[model samples]
Target: MSIRARLLSTIAGQLGNPHGTLGKGVAFMLNRSNHRAIAGAVEATGVTAGATVADIGFGGGAGLSLLLERVGANGSVHGFEISPDMLSRARSRFAGEIGTGRLQLAEGPMTGLPLADNALDAAITVNTMYFVPNLDAACTELVRIVRTGGSLVVGIGDPDAMAKMPFTAYGFTLRPVAEVIAALERAGCTVDHQQLANPPIPHHLLVARPA
Candidate 1:
């Protein structure tokens, strides 16, 4: 990793949590317009209370925490992150929820989540798809884990915006949102909603359902 990536990795490992830590940075990076657009798409899909949700590439755990709050005590949320450092912070931050068995954090990539097929009610990934080496495999894995009626929410900032960001100064290429949507559709996920917002940053929110 470059110096910048190493620094970000360190920071993410140290401060990220299940609440709003990493998300604050994400929100700031995306600016207000894109943030609202992504939020609107999520709300439209209806995560609902008591749903079994999984947040893939759950960076500081902000989205997962939000889902937790929405799902309430009767619901469950599972978070998956490949970064061991990030996973540690998330575990510490959500200790109470984990202890209560309402939230579970796994240290792994979304492509190989240790979950049963058709077990989740919903799942979401925000601005993390760019780092995935195999988008097709990742989408397949997502489809396998989500139930027939379950939803997959994906949000990605514009590649141009990301390239101009400090993180990309190190070495990160933004993934094409159009290609991602096409891949998801090829995997048999029905596209339920799609939205694009350009403000803080250009972003696209695509909500898909398992067929």
Candidate 2:
């Protein structure tokens, strides 16, 4: 691979599952850069007090933090991330909330979230779809984790815009928004699509619920 490819691969790997000292830095950047997607995705879920919600692929824990706050003292939040480093950071940062049973964290694969069927009042995932190896399982699992009237929010950058990034050349699957909506629909969801941001990223947020 060329030096550029090598760099792209390294960044791509870190983005997929952050780790070690360098990952610490990536985690910080993600928290700052992905705030809009994270916050909007959570809001799309309509999360409320006393409800149980989860932030899948919680990245730098920004989404997890938002969920924790929205769920409040009475509610609970479950966070699932594939990155051990990020999970450790979250565990440390939200120790008090975790100790009080207001937050739960898990490091695992996207295919299986370690959650019971219909366990969540709502769920949100931001910019993590491209890394999922199995789109079928990803779609199925998102719906499986949330109850029939419960909501799910998926956030991602437009495929055209994401294709502009070199890192996407390695291990990233640039899927069209329609393809994702179709997959979710097959899993029994009614998707509502809206552009969350344009130009630079062409970000989108898809809110869905069971038919």
Pairs that collide in candidate 1 are 31-200
Residue-level lDDT of model 1, residues 71-97, one tens digit each, is 899999999887665677678889999
Every model's TM-score: 0.79, 0.97
Strongest candidate by TM-score: 2
What lDDT would each prediction earn against the true structure? 0.72, 0.89
**Model 2: worst 10 consecutive residues (lDDT sum):** 194-203
Q: Which stretches of candidate 2 lie over 4 Å from their true place?
A: 198-200
Query: Candidate 1 regions off by >4 Å?
Result: 1-44, 166-170, 196-199
Error of 2 at 200 (Å): 5.7
* Residue 83 miss distance in model 1 (angstroms): 1.2
